[model samples]
Target: MIKGMGLSLIDSLDTMLIMNLTNYYKHARDYLAETLSWDRDIIVSVFETNIRCVGGLLAAYDMTQDEFFLKSAVDLGDRLLNAFQTPTGLPRTTVNLKTGAATNPSWTQQSSLLAEIGTLQIEFSYLSYASKQPRFAQKAMAVYDHLLTLMPEDKLLPIFINPDDGKPKGTDLVSVGALGDSYFEYLFKYWLITKKASRWGKEYFETVESILNTLAFKIVDQDEEMWYIAERQNKNINHKFDHLACFFGGLLALDAQHAPTEQMRERHMEIGKGIGAFCRKMYTMNPTRLPCDFVNIVGNTISNPIAAGKGWLMRPEAVETWFILYRLTNDTKYQEWGWDYFEAIEKYTKKEYGYTGLRDVTDSQKLEPDDVQQSYFLAETLKYLFLLFSPKDTIPLDKFVFNTEAHPLSFFEAQ
Candidate 1:
């Protein structure tokens, strides 16, 4: 057919990047070895690699007629599915790239109480879509089941949950407030993908609806900003919510899709806008030209009196506004803002040890890398920036890659 033409020279080059990027599979097994010292590299390879695989495989499947690329993506999907298995049903945050064993543990791994929970959904969904396998969906469903039972007493998800024991770990309602939307995003997304209309999804939707309704009316200050009320026991933390609270934009978009009222999506867009506006105000009000992490402090207020302010580099989520603005407007301003934010970070923060020195003002210009450089930062940061800066006509990332697990999940789609 004349409709299909020969590939351009650029296609070949892009293919090479995909191929070479993926060629590290053999080394993935030894990810924990000292040789691959950059935690980001190992995390990117074993865990975060899913984003690229999904991107490459999905892109190749849709645009190119390359069977090898598609099959390779499918094979990677299968390997990831197998790697994610755990007796407790909760997957580890970090795993030994080579040995297929659990390595480091972040509380976020279990409770995810946020979008981090969607890791399996993305992997399996891509596998299912790319390879047409039902097994991937089935594997992902198991994770949903496991995560559901781990919810805290108030129905509010915690910042962290213990992976091994299936219990709460640290910082009850602190880090990932997006855990709320994250759970709903995958639940509803799975429903859409499989057309199964899961009852679990129905229940989750109902609960999330109630929470959103409550958050809509509740205000911490006159600023008219709504935050997920952090619960210590029976009381509210009343701290100002950070936009990067967890999967805020993407999950909100997913929820907006299923909202019974059109106002829901509009409200979400408004929230996204508000975050940017607030950032602008903060820059002006502080007179420091530095972005504020969050408003209000609660609980014990550890190293920093500001509950959310670990520092400029510590806030992986400050970019939430940037991501949301771009998502809402599809304009370069947001992307430019994102780039500006990164530049400020690069200017004020230095990469040390492995982290971007969570505390910029406190580092005394000395480097004390992050205890955990956090794959989440790169996974979210690069994907958002890439989509923002990249050509919108050819590729617009409504969903970005988060992580890659080692297992053969192509079977999920096939089934």
Candidate 2:
């Protein structure tokens, strides 16, 4: 199980880096318009699919110093946040395509949607960072507080929660798929930005690390075989790719303890490499195949190649890992691979929509209807890719590292 600790541990450090990639996102930059076809238009989202079409717009605005992109990103964030204007604090997973308002009464889901809010928080984080607006940070923090209330004792959050009532509406155990990245995204970024262990930050990361430890040994015996969490009652190996979930817990564990035992480091490596290698192998074996749309052990590879776990070669999340790995090794191989994925995605998918993150990239790179274009795909994927390819000096590496708990790792603040 602890196969390549040195390498994987190195790679984990690079996850969700945000130095220069913020600039490379120029092409996919955000822009809102009222064209001939549509009556009203707006920005995209992270809560549900197809909601965030112009996610890269804000990043682009920030990167290029262009007012167009800045307004684009902010406008989109504002549009989505407005939709969550329920009497209750929670937000609907998706909004009206035309009106950009939540026609739904309220959201009952927390795990994935909370993750979504975290992604949105990042956009706001950037808005706050660039403009020094407390409002963006406040909005992002408010969503985090809402999610904090919903997390369970097991440290594994429930799938969905009633935003109106604040009760668990779904299964007891959380899906590693939906909540993992966003959970840590908020945890690490919030800590890095605020540097405060006050309130719930420390407790949040503690729970995240615990849940990830669950994956290191059992569910994923090896790196490649990620099993979906079938039930909260039992979380044993249901061997298959639960791709996003596979990444979730492991990522938190990556930087858990400074100078983590050699063994612990090794486990993280295997997990990272396994995921990368499996994705590579699975895709290589069937070049024409899109990544699995989404797989359940009962019926593996049921969805399109763009599915999770066992799917196509190019994924925002998968490629995002390579960027994380690149930061660790400084190995050109990972950087090279990162470009390869960008090329592959361009080659395989088309741009039906402006925003990119979706489960299935099988068709034209159309953002999925159910898929909310997450701000995270940009924070994690495009940002990492840009960092992978760009000079290290752009973002001042030292500024963005250091967890809220203050894990004294050199990687985030590499010399």
Candidate 3:
């Protein structure tokens, strides 16, 4: 957990940078430099380290113009490269810090999650660009090339892929949720960071259109139209949505403003608003103004059909979407909704140690706390909420693009 706090500190610094809190900036920078120096041999999970450590270092360097941060990022990037030593170039999930040994966990069945492999490109590519080490980006982009070769008939990728051979696992499952979320996210983000001239931009555009045509569906018989993207396995559609998947609405909204054609732009805007409304229901339908980890859409309404996993984990996707929609439309309704959501979290989840996950959001009387706060609660959830209420000039949407983890990266102009 201490290792993960590097991301939180960097995110706090980002907020400070935007607010021009120079005093706080110096404190943060000092603390970050100190933190980066501690425990050089602490083994780290690739995904966690990449998103937080590598991503944080890059963002910090960008904000501070500090060579120390960039040097640390390059060092971390070199250590992380050991995970990519597999035959097919899809990295293992974890790596040792000192020994540089890497391996997938025994339970993973020779396959890695799509999000794990696909999400590395943005940070790794940026590291390559900044550090002038082409190998980092080359290793990362190899995973993308391998995934393209294994694209399904529908062109949307499954959640798991064999790292050894770069093929989709036996399961036909496809989702924009947990195991799949950041794959699509980095696609668009990589395009933006690379200035839209790279293949990533074209892939992002194509994938969004494919998802709209294939994976996205509408809940039937609802008074107001609610569009929900679902997972498919072996021709069976699981009419469920995850809070994490809610990020798509905001992504769609952001992309809509940049769509090439007026028709395409309007279509994206419509989908974004529809998805945003559906996600809002995930909160308004609950007494606690918080959603379970996942919810089912059946016939006419969204339902918590699965009782076992009904919990809220301080996730930011829904609120993140609200922030983007609010930014795009300047609609006070999004702000109102966000404020209400924040109030509920403050009322229920706040604790002496830190905010925690809720075991059940529906039972307002006995909101059992899960007793752990994830780093993303700071890096993403609160950050998005803070940005939502801050002045528009702070991290102007036109000037920067955010990673899946909410770390902002400036657009790269090709030389």
Candidate that would win on lDDT: 3
TM-score for each of the candidates: 0.60, 0.62, 0.93
Q: lDDT by residue for model 3 over 1-415, one digit each (tens)?
A: 3643465675555656665679988887887677655335666789878887788778767777789889988888888898998888899888887788887776667678888998898888888888887898999988889888987666788876778877777687788987888898888878777778777777777888888887788763357776778888887888888888999999888888877789878988888878888888888888898888888877667887467768998899988898999989999899998998899999999999879998999889988998988777877888888889988877788878887777787877432
If candidate 2 were superposed on the true structure by all CA atoms, what would the RMSD be? Answer: 10.0
lDDT of each: 0.45, 0.46, 0.82
Task: Give the clash total for candidate 1.
Answer: 34
Q: What are the per-model C-alpha RMSD values against the true structure?
A: 9.3, 10.0, 2.1
State which candidate, 2 or 3, has the greater TM-score.
3
Against the true structure, candidate 1 reaches a TM-score of 0.60
Error of 2 at 226 (Å): 9.4
> How displaced is residue 389 in candidate 2, in Å?
4.5
Q: Give the lowest summed-lDDT range of ten residues in model 2.
A: 406-415
lDDT of 1 by residue, 1-415 (tens): 0111111211222333333445442233223122312112233223344544444344444444456556655655555553456655555555443345543344344332334445557555656666677776677666667667865544556545554565766565533343443454445545544444456546555655555544422333355453332323224544555434434444454445555578766765555454454444343333224444544434322122343463544343445545545655776666766676556556654455433544434333553344444333444444444445555432333332222211111112213
